[model samples]
Target: MASDGASNNERLLAAARDDNEDLLLDVFDQPGTFDINYQDGLGNTALHYAVLHTSYDVLDHILSHEECDVDPTNKLDKATPLHLAVEKEDPEDREYFVENLLEAGANYTIRNKHGETAEDLVKPGDEVILALFRKAQADADANMDDIAYEDDDDVASEGSD
Candidate 1:
């Protein structure tokens, strides 16, 4: 049973690393067979592998999982997948991943061992990535305001009773 679990984790990690979406989806579909956040020897989860390997398809599948932790950190560096995505050499790929990650609710404020948040890692003059981060922050702030307003209304209604 231990071997099975270990092998399943290896298979899942390999699928992410190789960008084999079909294999990844197959493994994920089997209930309780594999954890979505299964970490490798270096404590890098499947999400981290997807980002490092530039496997957007694998990433999308992982992000769609209800239990997915978008900001999972690698054990060795404490670097979240978002932090790794920011380090992509290709600007277009980097921007795409950043946008998708934010949309998938990746925490922009999560700092790595180096104390660098995803926003902090942005290269200077990269206005596009910076704008995407700002938009996510604005959206998050708006959501908090809405929640607070709803709570206030609920309190007032209870008081009126």
Candidate 2:
């Protein structure tokens, strides 16, 4: 069951690279196709792969699923999906994606095993990106009460004003 699950997850990730948003929706609509946060060999979820490849549609699909948390940390790196996106994307993109992730309930202030917060990964004083980062941070801090992911894999977030 475990390896089958793993192989299925690998397929899901490949679909993400192909930018097939429907694949995840299909999985979610099925009886029990995914563990939602399941990781493959390198501690990456379908979420991570989607972001790595900049599959915007797939990213949207995963974020829309109630069974997936926006802040799920990879087991080996203890890095959230947001963290991986920050590391992999360019600065402007990192800011926008991080804001979406935070508003979706990622704890933006949290660091990984490398002691690097998403904020730290960004270069200092890159104005356009910095503004968005600050906006995201402020939004995250203010909405702490409004953003939450339940232990049972439920995701609910604040209405952005």
Candidate 3:
């Protein structure tokens, strides 16, 4: 049973790395076949492999899954998927992955082993990526503000009661 689980996890990682959506879907269909966030020997989850290999479709599928965690850190570098996205060699690919990851709730504030956040890895003079980070931060702040306001309203209503 343990080996079966390990095999399933390897298949999951391979599906993500190879961008094999069919294989991924098949794995998902099998009950108890794999844990969506199962980390390999390197502590790298399927999400991490998708980011490193630029498997956009697989990445999207993983991100959209309810079981998926957007910010899992690998053991070696303690790097999250967002960290890998920022380090993409191609400019366009970098933007696409960064945007998708951010939209899927990736936290840019998460620090790796080196204490460097995803935003810190952004190339100098790359205002486009910086703007995306700023926007995500602003959106998060707004969400907090909204939650606080709602809580305040609840408190006021309770006082009146």
Candidate 4:
């Protein structure tokens, strides 16, 4: 009856560009995929769409909502949001999302069953992306250092106990 407004594809595309969770929720909540490919091309639930879109709003919505599966991967590709974010173009923003996912236990080192790490997908010559990836790797490595130190400290403290 009313103008369909944007084409469904266009609407879905906008949901990514606009990066609004509330709006994306409405769009994805409908019958089919909000654009999650892991669940199947048409089956990639709303949460899956949010990651690829890199929409802060949509991402937040998905992360907070328990139903929004954070780990869905494309059947053939085996790409999780972390994998998507790693592969996606935005260096700074995508890296930020990676950090969040890692905190959530999203495996940063996970490969797509092809024996490739998230590090492999990054643009090799791109300075920004490479730098960001390097930083993340360093940070992950540092966390391990902290654990080692904590273990040493615990052993020392145990002497007093």
Per-candidate TM equals 0.93, 0.72, 0.93, 0.59
Instruction: By TM-score, rank the candidates, best first.
Output: 1, 3, 2, 4
Q: Write the per-residue lDDT of candidate 2 for residues 1-161, one digit (tens) a residue.
A: 12345455666777676777676566666647667677777778877777777777877777777777677677777888777767754765666566567667766777888888877776666566556567777776666645543422342233332
Candidate 2 residues lying further than 4 Å off, grouped into runs, are: 1-7, 89-92, 144-161
Residues 1-161 of candidate 3 have per-residue lDDT tens digits of 12355577788898888988987887888858788999998999989989899887788788888988999999999999999999999988899999999999998989999999999999999888999999999999999999999999999999998
Scored by CA lDDT, what does every candidate get?
Answer: 0.87, 0.68, 0.89, 0.62
Over 51-105, each residue of candidate 4 has an lDDT whose tens digit, in order, gives: 6767777666556544445666666667677777776676677777776665555
Worst 10 residues of 1 by lDDT: 1-10
Flag the better candidate by lDDT, 2 or 3.
3
Candidate 1 residue lDDT tens string, 35-140: 8888877989988988898987787888888988898888888999899988899999899888889999999998899888989999999999999999999999
Candidate 3's displacement at residue 126, Å, is 1.2
Residue runs of model 1 more than 4 Å from their true location after superposition: 1-6
Candidate 3 — which pairs collide? none
Per-candidate clash tally: 0, 0, 0, 3
RMSD of each: 2.7, 8.3, 2.7, 6.7
Best by TM-score: 1
The predicted structure with the larger TM-score, 1 or 3, is 1
Q: What is the Å distance of residue 117 in model 4 from its true position? A: 1.7
